[model samples]
Target chain A: MCAMTSAQRVFTTLSHQEPDRVPLALNLVLRGARELGLSIRDYFSDPANVVEAQLRLQQRFRSDVLFGFFHAALEYEAWGGEVVFTEDGPPNSGAPVLGSHQPLSSLRLPELAASKGLLKVLQAIEAMKARVGDEVPILGVAVSPYSLPVLQLGFDRYIELLLGDRAEFWTLMEQNIAFCQSWANAQLAAGASAIVYFDPLASPTLVPRSLYQDTGFQVAQRTFAGLKGPTVTLLASGRSLGVLDDLAATGTLGVGVSCDEDLAQIKAACRGRLCVIGNLNGLAMVDWSPAEAERQVKAALAQAGPGGGFILCDTHGEIPWWVPDDTLMALGEAVQTWGRYPLVGAEAHA
Target chain B: MEARTLRFEAALLSMDRVLCRSLLQEAMGEERQLEGIEHLLGPALAHIGDRWEAGELALTQVYMGGRICEDLLADLCPTSSTPVAGGPRIGVGVLLDQHQLGKRIVASSLRSCGFQVLDYGQGLEPLELARLARKDQVPILMVSVLMLNSALRLRELREALGEGPERPRLVVGGAPFRFNPRLWQEVGADAVGQTGVDAVAIAQRLLEESCAP
Candidate 1:
């Protein structure tokens, strides 16, 4: 078989067919800033820097996917939500938008065209699409409306409102889904291959299976129904074993699995239905030896690589800022050597 | 196995704060808020924590339960303005990661249990945390983290905080430690809490040990 381009490899893998190798979508965000000798604030200050850094990273690692996501707070920030950006990690919410003093019903939905942070993300996606064209897949991210409350109202408060006030909760969900659809569709229109439907709250790790079924699942079903393009529902390193069936039912093309889950079981469960994107421990990756990195990569490949429906990626979707550059190099190298089609370790998984 | 404890647990799981507060008031009889926390609320929260660990309960239950209890403590004991005398000075903060929900719950639980917990804020560096500990003269500092990288940084935090009889007892908690049972010790913590309720017990025991003559 001829060697495939990154886009071909990813699309083929999503179709459950073995390409030249498993596609890699390293969720490098702050790491990109570090590569260019720029502070995180400076790196994200201009959308051009985000594009340049991502292109440089793709060139250096020779990975399959390009991420157009910067941070989750950007979505909330677009709606006048206060966000704080630091040197070490991605930006985080500064304060709760729906505090007791500021009720959800009283708030007005901000216009999408006026959102600076979100527009910057769309601009980055457009630039990357202009640069890479169809040769590589660019992955965009849209926080699930069901879970965006965690970023908007704070996790603790969101849980209270979710469980205590059903009326207000659904009202918040209605507003969020509208914003989420617009944001996700804009990314797709901007030339992204797919948007990651980032929804950590739906994971059984955060909420009970019963509650998720009643709330997050239904909300996700509605949210996914309106999206114009394909999406991969990401649980952000949260355990998804208990909710795999529900995740498969969310109309997503793929589901990002946590490192804590059994990869083979996940593959068997999603077989012929949804592409399994990950299970690599981003946390452990910080301290991995090159040999250890290879071993871990092979183990994951052995577990889910046989069916050709897996995309190798970090569990949390985004790689940590503190993870050494050498470690990422080792991971890329390991994938190149062992991730080829007709994988030697297929028997172990089969 | 008391009926009130079980009922209180159920109320918290259901997030019925009115019923929860009434149950606590009934269970308390005429005792103080600390007594209710010790005899009723503590055990109920612990049972909820166990259920959560066993996958029988949701994280929302645990979190809301803590928040509800914090509010109840404020309402029930409106004049309990200070920490119990002779207790070890306690402080709480999130390490590197900005996820501060866990820290807030722990701090509130500790405060409800009559410990004056100094809030050191979130995303604090090791040096900044150490400086805060020194400036505040806090003896027992509880640190929470959601990410593994942040959890591992406890070693650097421990070093910066120093090693001596006077150094604060580092208490660690959060998802990573819960995932890896032995991670707390590996990260140089003196103790680890499985939940906000567990933080109360751990703080009490640490204080007892510190005050030993």
Candidate 2:
């Protein structure tokens, strides 16, 4: 096997082609920075600071892929949702400017290029592309329609409306899907090689399978259809494993499994069609020692690596802010050292 | 058995109805509203929680059953009524390090149970919350942090409010407290609620206890 760019490794794995080694996709953001003795507030507000932090992360971990940005609020900010920006922290979504009872005719979705936070994200993407686009695959993150609703209405209001009204729900879904489609396409146009659609709120843990099918599925289907590049859909919560096959059918390049899903079950459900990009516990990385982090990463590799369709990553999102820098480094080192092909089967390891 | 069954059945039907409403309202938003959830959902969940604590129901059964209840709640109850009081309001929010579900649930439940709940939503900063607390002259500051790291913000908020003549009472909750009960003390919360209902009860109790003096 030869060394491959993280983009090549991820794209190849998604295509089910053999890669030099399993790609390690680091969702580096606030938490990753905290581990490195950097401030989360400082990185997000300053584009240059973000680049410096990301470059530092890449230098420290030598991860297969170096990804930037954190949280799914960027598109929300662009889509008429107000963001209450914190000086040294991730931004919070303000109350929805548009209420549910308001006629669908009232809300016209914003063009992706014209949105607020999106330009910053685009600028970051362009900056990253200029610097490292050739060396690594740049993944642009966007919120799924289902998640966008959560941001716009606030999680509580969104969930309530979902329970209370069905017809209007589908309508909202359509509108959000259109919004995400345009947003994702713009990112791809701006030089993002891949788009990661994060539906953090669409976890089966919160919504039933039937509701997910009825409401979230179609929006996801349409959003993925609008994307020009390889796309990854992250069903961020673990309880969605029961609907893994349903998610895989969205025609995404891969599905990001949460820490709670069994690797074997996800792989079985994916059936070599979609790649799998997770199962390592993000919370553990926050608190575990370096040796422990390495051990967990190695264990994940043993379970998820073999057969070329796995991209090692934290089950969902970035490492939390409290994790030690050494632990994160060890995780990267473990993936680099032990994530080679022909993974020793779990039974053999036992 | 009959009363329990009646409440359970009412709860189940109510949960189903709420779930139906939530599914229909999926377009409205994602936040769990307490006003819509209070009537049947709250009592049912309280019943379920009590039953589980008494060993009358299994954890798996409660979890599975609660998820069914939550799914209904998620759809039906989305958003709390904006706090009505004209006093200094403490704008409580979830730390970026934590999940907002538990906090939102508690905030809404508190609102219905009669506290002026200013839900700052999820992934909020401690300084912002503290600023809101000061601006609102919020008598009680409740911060719900599920992750241990996010819990550190409570201490930061406390420091921000340090030695103030009008510092509000601080309350904290969520899963992290289950293992490390001392986190409430460490984070400088005056009290901590173990569950949503307990949160309401604790807040009320704290208020009552304070007012009595």
Candidate 3:
């Protein structure tokens, strides 16, 4: 095969066909903030700074995808929720909208153009697209309708409502789907090539496998189905094994698993069905030497790369601010170096 | 694990504070809240945590369980005039973890177990822990380490805790401690516990050791 653009390589790999090399999609948020002398607070405040930092990281690493920037509290803030901003970390959803007994119909997906925090995100998407055009695929980030509730209503509180008040819970899910549709449309219109939706609640650590399939899957399926571009879903670091088939059932083109999952099993499960994009232990990438991190990436590639349909990325959606730039760069280098397809005879490949 | 306990667990799962308090009162009949916790509530909460881990329950359910335990402890724990043998004045809080529901449960359980636990809240810096220990003259300091940031700062926290004849004994617990049993030792802690009951046992022993003539 001839040389491929990162987009083509990603497209090819997701199709269960080998490209010249494996594709890489790095989710840079706090990791980039630290490098640019921008605090998490500063990063959330400026669209230009975010795009500039993204381009700098892209130029340095030449990764295949730039997972879009998110302010973490955008939706909560959009819903008039108070977000607690700290100098050292991401903002916390201080007071949940549903902190008290708010009726389910009270939830609203307001016009993005009317909301400042969310509007900034839409503008940032446009900025990244205007700057990087076709250089790399930009993945507009959207919290899955299921996972997004944890922001507006705290995780524990929301789950309480779900279990205790089924009527209100479904209403909340309906609101989420409605919100996601418009939010994703804004991103798609702003030039995001794809939507990377994250819904950690579907993972085994939060909801039962049966519960996720029955409720979480439906919420996600509708949310992903409405997306204007290709979709990739992220599962938080939890017991996700029980829900793989359910995840595949959502009809996302690809799935992002945590670093803790076994790759071989996911590949077998996703075989010729879904693109498998992960399992590089985020901690190992943060703590290990570059060479060790590279080896770890190669090890993940050996299992996830062979038959194609794999992308190299940190299993965690966010890397620690302390994770070194060299370590981040090393991931791209390893994929380009050792992630070639058509695995040779065992001894030679090793 | 009993049907009665299961009923309590179910009520707690739905965030029913009234029913939970009633069930807890029944379970505690004539026993210390610590005893009830160790025997009844603790196991129930642990089971909820298991379900949460197994995907049978949500983290929200676990948090709601913690809240129910907290509300019950408000009535059940502080009223125990009959003090236990190992009761001591100790300071307790989580280090660097905003998820204080687990720590709150641990602190409440310790209070019921007869320790006078200082509620330092979560997001405590190592320096604050040292100051609280020294200022309060607490002989046994219990700090919960759950986040990686807290774990990384353990060595510094140990040094910041200072050295003196009245130096508080450091007893560690939480997932980070369970993740590495030897972590407490690395942080220069006197002991570590895998559970709230174990934490009380370890704290008592450490307190007794600190008081050794």
Candidate 4:
């Protein structure tokens, strides 16, 4: 097998084609930055720092794709929510603006392209693209419309509105979809080759499967359908596997699975259709030894990597301040060593 | 039958299904307040957390149910329940990087157990929280930091209180503390509550202990 660049390997795997080896992809975000010893606050506040962090992250993981923004708060921050910045932790909302039983009509949805922090994100994308457009696949991260509404109107209120009024909920989703389309289009125009929609809150662990399918999944489908770039929809919790087929049908290039889902099951469900990008236990990287990390990564590769359509990554973003550096590095090294393809026969097709 | 049994049944049912919708509705009020529900809201939530921790519920069930409870608490600001006359005001908030559920429940439990409770919500800066405690004239400040990193901020809150004679007694709790017992002293908290029931008892003990001198 010939040597291939990390970007070439990752995009090839994502495209369901053979690469030199299975790609080691880090879903780089604010949390991963802290794990990598960079400052999350500094990254967002300074454009130069953002550029440095992106390059360092790409170098460290030898990642196939480059993620532009770090957290999901930018969209909410742009949609009239006050983001409470932490010293080194992920930023959270100041206070929820929408109330229970509050009519969705009372809220004014902002135009996605004109939101504040979004421009900063777009600028980051432009900077990253300008810097590494030819070297890496610049993947822009966007919050799903269903999850965006949770950010705009606090999660509780958003879920209530979703459960109580379908028409109004979908209208809100339509607005969010419009925002995502414009936001994604802007990022793509700025040089993003693909987009990853992070929808952690939409997990079946948070909402019932029926509600997720009816509201979250549908909104996600519409949002992905509107995106111009190749898209990866990340279902961040394992509880969403029962609906993996529905998720796969959303027209995304692949479905990102969380650690809780059975790898074999997801591989089987996603076979012949969309590719599978993750399912490694992220918390294990925090507490496990390097040897243990390698062992687990090898096991995950054995289960999910043999085929051409798999990309290796954590089930979720790295937890800040807890995960050890060596464990993360071990994961990357393990993927490089053990994730090669052309398995000796019958198992190769699997 | 006993009230505990009834409470247990109500708690189990709430954890399983009933209370989530109403709680979500209550938290997300029609206009978006999401703050005041943490008083009685805490016990209701604790009952659910207890069930989950005790293996009576699955993680997914606990999360989905907990999200509903948290959503409700997040919507309502702390409101006085028949304002305690001459009762020492107690302010409750989560340390930076910590989610507010367990802290909110502790605050709610404190109120039901007869302490004057003020829920400051989640991810508060140590200095800001200390300032709020001083401004509110709270005699007891209950802090909850769920994440290990945030647990260190309790010490910051203590330093912010300084040598002031009016400093409120501090109580801390959460998962990080459960993992690291030494955090109670490391964070400089006067007392630490391991559970919601224990938190209420600690508040009562502190009130009595402070009144003795």
Candidate 5:
């Protein structure tokens, strides 16, 4: 077989065709900053730095995906909300901007072109596209309209609003869906291959399936339907197997699963419908031995490598900056060694 | 389960707060306020927690149940400063992450069960948390972390607090620890709570163990 470029490998896998090996997509967001010897806050402050760091990281980690995300808080930051970045972990939105006192009526969607921080992210995506072209796939991220309220209103408050007042919840969703469509379409226009529709709150782990069916599931369906490019709905909230049908019904090309789920089961469920992209325990990766990393990669390959719809990735959307370099290196090396199509030692492990 | 408890659990799971409040009133009519919570509300939530663990119930169910129970307890049962006299001092806080839903639920659940808890608040660094726990003389500290980086800091916290009879027994819970079952032990925590209900049970057992010696 001819050697495939990272883009080819990912596209091939998404098409359910055998790539040379399972594509590696280490969700290195903050880790990109770490590679550049800059603070997460400093690295993300400049679009040029974000581009340079991500390209350098792709060179180092050899991941198939170039992340076009800084933090979810950036989405809210564009709405005149504040974001607080720390030395460790992703930034969090400061003191939620929406609640009973403030209300959704007080806010209006900011023009994506005018929002400096979001414009910078789009600029980074455009720059990354120019540099890599179609040789590698750059992924843009947008929090789903159903789940974006977690940033605007805190989790508890959001849940309260969602369950308590249908009118306010739908009104809030209308505003968020508009921003989400605009933001996602802008990224697609900037040359991202697909938008990762991050909807953690949609996961059954967080909300009841019946409630999700009534709220988030329908919102995701509408949001994904409006996106200009391919999308992958990521439920990082855990145990998303129950919603495979609903996620597929959202018209996404793939789903980013959680660590607590079974890869083989998810792959089987996604067969012929959606590509399965994850389940690696990002938390456990912080302390994984090289041997353990290899074992996990082999097991994942064994379970899901039979088909071409699997991309190896961390369960959580973003790999924590503190995960050891050696562990990530081991994960990459193991995929290269054991993840070849017509998978070796697959059955023994399976 | 008894008919009243089952009906109450159903009301809680459905997020019918009004129904839950009415049920609690009915239970209070039959028993003392504390007894109603301990026997009725506590068992209902624990059942929901167990079902969540067994993959039969959603976390939202547990969360809403806890919130409703907290609201009911607050209104129906006036909070006494010394709900349980000489109860082991339990401290709860979220380390490094600002997500407070898990901590809020666990803290409320603990209080519902009549345990005295000192909520040190969220975004506490390891050393700062250690200092606060020590100063408060917290015997059992339950820390919640929404991210793995924060969970890993439990090692630093354990080291700072040190190991001794007087040292607070670390009880860890939240997303990371819940995802990885053995992570609590790995991070030097004495135990891990899979859910807020589990935290209540773990705290009670830890308190009983402490009181034994």
Candidate 6:
């Protein structure tokens, strides 16, 4: 059989079929900034800079899927919330726009396409597609409604709304769902292979499991249903089986797991239902020795690689800013070495 | 483990400050206010910290509990003091991190422990923290960095504080510290706290040790 392309491998994995190897990818930020030797502010400004940095990264390391985080810090800015930009990391929201006396019912949705930050993200996606073409899968990201309320209503007020004014919270969830659908559709149309509904705030770490499921998960169900093709749900942390069943029911093609989670349980939850594409502690792996990194890759492949639906990847799909280039390349080396299909037919691919 | 503590936790969980304040006032009555704060409410908030680690409590709820505890502490004590003039009047803040709730909780917990905590809130530059510490002549500087990016600034913060013998003692706690026990130590923080309550205890001890002749 011919060597499958990255998009081919991902699509095959998404279809729950065996591919050339377990698809490998990274969740990256600031790498583009580093490539151009520019501040994050300067690097993230132009679609060309993001594409150039990603292309340079591809030249050094082999990633089966290319992920651009242009959408990561945009939701708050797009929603008219003030964001503080740093040279080192993504933009941070200052305060939530909504408050008491300003009723939730009085709010009007901002035009996501018209928002410069989101428009820049779409521009980056289009530029990535124009340059990379069909060989690699370019994954876009959409912030979930569960995570957006933190910017829209602020944390303190949002919590009160969750417990005291749940009816209004649900209405906000509906609005968030609409927002995500619009954003996801725009990115998909702009040439993204997949757009993961990224929920950094819906994690059990941030909210009660019951509350997350009741409020966040409900919004995610609708949000995921309306997104374009081959999408998945990327939880900031997926350390339990609580939301997997409902997550599989979200109509997403895959589920992104984390290292804190039991891989066996994730495979059990996702196998025959949805694609499973993570578990390696991506952030900490860079600090691990090459031998240990390779060992982990082999271990993940051995455990989760049995089924066809598994696409091996780092947790949450993000590579932290401090990771060294050599360490990242080492991960790719591990993937290329140990990520072969049919343990018996390893020699055939080799 | 008392029934009142459980009821108090329940009141906090409801997110109704009015009902929670009423229940807390009724529980404290007039005499046992300090005991209620340190023993009952303090331990309860610490328990909520454990729940946060176990993914049971929300960030918002924790913030609410912290605010309520702080208010109750103010109502009970009415007057407090730190390490006199040039002593360890501690300065605490969230360092370039978006999540301020944890630091706020830790600050409130320290106040409940009878320390005069000047909380600078969230997204503060490490240099800003150092400048404030120097100007205020604070002896203990506690920082909460819940994210990786925020934790990365600790060395810079240490540099800003300078290595003088009279410089403030540095302490840290948050999600990043929990990830690596030696994270704060690597960043030059003198100490690390496992929880908000633990941070208070640690900060107090660090302050006392610094003030020891």
Q: List the residue pairs that clash in candidate 6.
A: A27-A317, A27-A318, A27-A319
Candidate 4 per-residue C-alpha lDDT over B174-213 given as tens digits, one digit per residue, 9 for 90 to 100: 7556544676887788988765445655766787887787
Question: Each model: TM-score of chain B?
Answer: 0.90, 0.65, 0.67, 0.65, 0.91, 0.76
Using TM-score as the measure, which candidate wins? Answer: 5
Higher-ranked by DockQ: 2 or 3: 3
Order the candidates by TM-score, highest first — what do you get? 5, 1, 6, 3, 2, 4
Which lDDT tens digits does candidate 4 get at residues A1-350?
88887677877887778788877777556644564465666657755566667678668866677777756667767777677666655666655545445666776767755775787777888898888867788888887777776556654455546666788887887777887888888888888888887776455545656667777777777787777888877766434566666777777777777665678777877776778878666544556799887787777776776668888777664344566768777777876666777633213322
Task: Give the best candidate by DockQ.
Answer: 5
User: Where does candidate 5 stray beyond 4 Å?
Assistant: B1-3, B29-33, B79-89, B126-132, B159-167
Please report how far candidate 5 places residue A285 from its true position, in Å.
1.0
Tell me the tens digit of each residue's lDDT in model 5 across A171-203: 988988999999999999998999999988777
Global lDDT of model 2: 0.64
lDDT of 3 by residue, A1-350 (tens): 67887778888888888888888877776556766787778777887777888778776776787756675577777777777665544565555665457765666766787888888777888888887778678888777888887767655567667667877778878878888888887888888888877788888766767667778898887887777777878875555667778877888888887655678888888888888988776644546788877777777878778888988776756665556778877777877778766644211444
In order, the candidates keep a fraction of the true contacts of 0.33, 0.02, 0.33, 0.04, 0.54, 0.33
Better of 1 and 5 by lDDT: 5
Per-model DockQ against the true two-chain complex: 0.39, 0.10, 0.31, 0.10, 0.58, 0.36
- lDDT, candidate 5, at A102: 82
For residues A1-350, could you state the per-residue lDDT of candidate 2 as single tens digits?
67777777777888876687778877666654454455554556656666666767766776666564655666666767666544344555555656656654576788765765677677777777888867788788888888777656655556657777888777888888888777777778877888888875455645656667777777788778777877787766344565676687777778788665678777767758878888777654555788787777777777767777888887765655555778878877877777766565322442
Regions of model 6 farther than 4 Å from truth: A95-108, A238-240, A343-350, B1-7, B14-32, B55-61, B71-89, B163-166, B194-197, B211-213
Candidate 1's C-alpha runs over 4 A off are A98-100, A346-350, B1-11, B16-40, B50-56, B71-89, B95-98, B111-136, B146-163, B175-189
Docking quality category of candidate 2 according to DockQ thresholds: incorrect
Any idea what lDDT model 6 has?
0.73
TM-score of chain A of 2: 0.89
DockQ of model 3 vs. true complex: 0.31
**Candidate 5 chain A weakest lDDT stretch, 10 residues:** A92-101
Interface RMSDs of the predictions, in order, are 2.9, 6.9, 4.1, 5.0, 1.8, 2.8
